[model samples]
Target: MSEWMVTQGSTARRRARPLSPLREYLRDTFWFAPMAAMVSVFVVWVGAQALDTAIVEALRDEGDYDTLDELLRFAEDAKAVVSAVGSAMMTFIGVVFSISLVAVQMASGQFTPRVVRIFVRSRITKATFAVFLATFVLTLLVLASFDSVDDPRAVTTVPLVQSALTLCMVALSLLLFVLYVNTTLRLMRISHVIARIATESFRVAASMPVSTGGQDDAARLGSATAWVPHEGRAGVLRDVHIARLVRVARRHGVVLRLIPRIGDFVVPGMPVLAVHGGPVPPRRALRYAVSVGVERTYHQDLGFGLRQLSDIALRALSSAINDPTTAVQALDRVVQFLAALSRRPLDAALHRDRGGAVRLVQPVPGWTELVDLGFTEVRMCAIGSPQVCRRMLAGLDDLLLLVPPERRQPLLRHRELLRQAVDRSEPAPADRAFALHPDRQGIG
Candidate 1:
């Protein structure tokens, strides 16, 4: 029997737990019910006073009980109606209060005070002004009602000072409302204007080209040339085209350091890498330096294409110098081809000349050959930063240009290797690569 009783008790406890929501709702309604009752009391009081006044006035004027009795009966009926309305309102207020209490309880631990403060501050000013205006209007209506009262003793005349005070309150309320609306609209307009100006300024800044220093005269150029140290610790070049320049620098036995790693910013007139081993020809070094500066600026302006072009040109130039057969004619032919391509009308077909004449030479085959030779890489990197890898790719492209068509596949394989190297070295964000975790549950 004791074990049976224990099992029953457990069942009862579970049943009780399910009713907690209803119980919580009922508890919350208790506090707000009284407020509704008070409002109902106020309504009844006003109605009863107005009806009693009408009945007394009618009785005194007509000297009859019929109308007075009828009015009294009507007032009683009205009272009953009002009482029913009041009771319904009380129930509704209770329900609302209960729901609010439950909501507050649910949020108690999680609610941030700072967020609450922000909400309160935003609404308090507007709510206070509304209350003040309502009070002022009510006061004016009450003063106007005094003039309509039948009894002379009950209808007291408002003093001039009191009348002025009432008028002042009404005026103040109107003024405050106008001020609030004006200030809010002005602030919103100013904020929108400022935001637009800031957005335009940022767009302009991002589009502007990076600047570089220029030598004013031959004498200044000569002075700038002296700034390049004859002997110093070699520093690695940070630019993407540095690899190509390294090869050129290597031939001259200058200790050329190709700056490895990424995100290093180089300023104008700053040495990207320190040259060492021996005194290199200042004129040749200056030319390389100036070319590099120009390439960097171009990359900043035109993006990766022009940088690659410059790199390829420099590499081709370097290779031609080394080889006996191709040294003289390689640069001239390439330059002539480039000039012709640039001058051709945008709509002109490759197969025909501008005057509908048969072309003297096919441009596509030559262009393809140059591309196959690795000249494309130099061309792309020429307009970019003169980092070692870029310069090296440019050299490879130049070397490819000299290679026979049959050997193009091997050159392409080498270019792929260089591209892989560059990809591996470049810095990238981790979040962009792969996600480690997945969300397990749905969120509202």
Candidate 2:
């Protein structure tokens, strides 16, 4: 790899997520969205109550007896409906998500465990959960503040605004229920599942800036000191506070080359970065710039998206499933990601100081490694499935056309291996010839 530009902005002003681990947690967990909705529901309920009181007072000043009687009668009618919503909404929430969870589980099993992460990260799933929670909680709050009760001793008042708001919530809930069901059903279909994963992978790829490699900078800054983990156990490295690391390196008058790439596992006491010249920064400062988790995430790990796409393909190609068409579908996405990625420059990252001196260097996957990751395993697993074999050949041929001549070797190598696999697996010349033929739609 040659030289590359990682960031165009001033290193000090560059965006950084210091609390990325916590942010990632918010993205992956199921409870946070509904919890936020529960809190917001109270605010909406309070505003409705205040509005109702103000309107009632205004009506009484004008002595609008007929209008007041009409509103009171409507509120009385709404009480029964509101009570029904309060009871039904909670039960509905439990039942709906329960079934959704089961569906999610079956999809995950059918595709890959990574689909569960995608499910939790889905914007629709989160929004549906939040709205349902808001509707349920808001209805309860509206019910508790009901002023037009049936008790004779109780002073009666019409909660006009509350009644309307309650009805609106019910209507929205029904509308969202339809949408939720549609979304849940789509999740079960194989095509939609792979397409969704591919879409997410593209998002991750777009977030990454074009680069070549930062090893040249690291080479110039020789004889470095190592900064090891300050505390905590080992985990798969997820996020790095890049701005903070640059700041620390600048302050210490040293260059930092991150030792482990994102998604690389690091144990305690292992070197996190090599401090090239100058004294090492405080342990806490360096430690604070890094975060580790039990599992890999798409937050910064670009390969994680490919890993997920590949997992689904592998699962479909498994002996138990024996579903080559599904594998072909996954390969279609994998090829798309690879083809798009190949057209861009990808190597390592560079973080520079205010003076334009490279202060931090982080290595990323090169094109060769990425090509291997995308095709190597799939080619091996495509043995008995002629449809998958044809699709893999088509994917390689498509990539060869999209990428430059220098990047064609990886594709060509996979091509040879694929042909050999077909020759070895299929004894009949007709089947082997069919498998060797490149078909984008597999058998189609």
Candidate 3:
């Protein structure tokens, strides 16, 4: 059972990777372009026949091919002309259809199965096909009429005029198709160029350093202390048995002001927030707070980083709203932001010496260590929203009372401090009221 489970997990991971470039190209080309071409061919054939009929009636006074023999000969001749003209028209229409489909797909960032379905529904393929068919039918009708001209001299003039008209129609169709195709293709290429630019910008942002301090920085670095339960169970983590932890230390006193915001890259042992001024005793409480806070901060940073990445992806999809180059530049900025967030370094400055020789900082005291352990467990509670954070903190305050008096004294003190901080941090009720009543701000 264990082996099977492991194999299944490995298979899922393999499936998650991005499709190969060759596979992507083939899928798009075969599904989108070829489908459009087929539709265009059918349309061109119908259109030529319709145009041929109209021209024939306009040029000829009456029907001359009354007998079966004359009618058969005229039919053969007309078929030849229609087939020739329709083939050329189909080619022109196919090019335009293919271009338009590719352009829309590129702009939308929908290089997936779902996107393909939407493209088919857009009807560019069907519309082009219909137009080509109409043109073909019209051309064939006109060519058939010319075959009935009686006088020898009239024969030369009528056929000559019909051929000229047919050529004109074909030329116009080809010209229109080429122009449309070129415009669409250019737009699609522009969108792709913008996406590439945005990707590069993100890479640059990720390369920037998160801290500049030498060994001193390590002491300031935060620590991931515990896991927390998630608020809801309907989405990504629902029924998954995993929860997202918040930075408890961040809430207590420390805060992360670096890039990537939160919810980005976070490893188990990384420091996620900076430690601020605090009491030395109740070492256990401090340790617990620090550990929980560090974990929470990392989780928050990870979330923020992921959000930024999503924004960049969205910008790529919206390239058609403006010039492709301009969009690319905007996306580049988003990418840079993401890069900066992900480039944070591990803490390496915990051993800074105040004077002569460098000395190791002592491990947190036992009492403080115990407090830190409890804090770690609480942090794992995964309080995400501000409301949840408030609730969790409130619950911790009540729970601390259950601890024996000796242990509880320090914790109770810290809990009171945390409560006071939360009170001070809460936005003023008036501010909330004002937000709800925009008119109070003098807005019409």
Top lDDT model: 2
Per-residue lDDT of candidate 3, residues 384-426 (tens digit): 1233233334434544544445455645554555445444554
lDDT of 1 by residue, 1-444 (tens): 232234334443321111132333333233333344335434543554465456466565666556544444544444344334434434533443354344334222222111122222223234324434343333433333333333423432222222333345446545654554453333233233222222322222222211111112111212121124312223322123333334445555444332212222344455443344455434454343322221121111212222233332353345333221121122223332322222212211111123432211101112333333334443333221223334344444554565556545745765676455444544453421211111111010
Q: CA lDDT of 244 in candidate 1?
A: 39
Model 2 TM? 0.88
Q: If scored against the real structure, what TM-score would every candidate get?
A: 0.21, 0.88, 0.26
lDDT of each structure?
0.33, 0.78, 0.37
Worst 10 residues of 2 by lDDT: 1-10
- Best prediction by TM-score: 2
Q: Which regions of candidate 2 deviate over 4 angstroms?
A: 1-19, 57-67, 147-156
Candidate 1 clash figure, as a count: 38
Candidate 2 lDDT over 1-444, as tens digits, reads: 011112222222434445466778888788998899888778877888888877767777777767777776677778788888888888878878896788778877788887877666777778777888888788777777766444322324567777787788778878878887888788888899888776666655655544444556556778776555536668988888888888888888888888888899988888888888877788777766888888887666778777877788888899988888888888888887887777676667787878877888877777898888887887899898888888989989989888999899989999998898789888999988988999999999
Candidate with better TM-score, 1 vs 2: 2
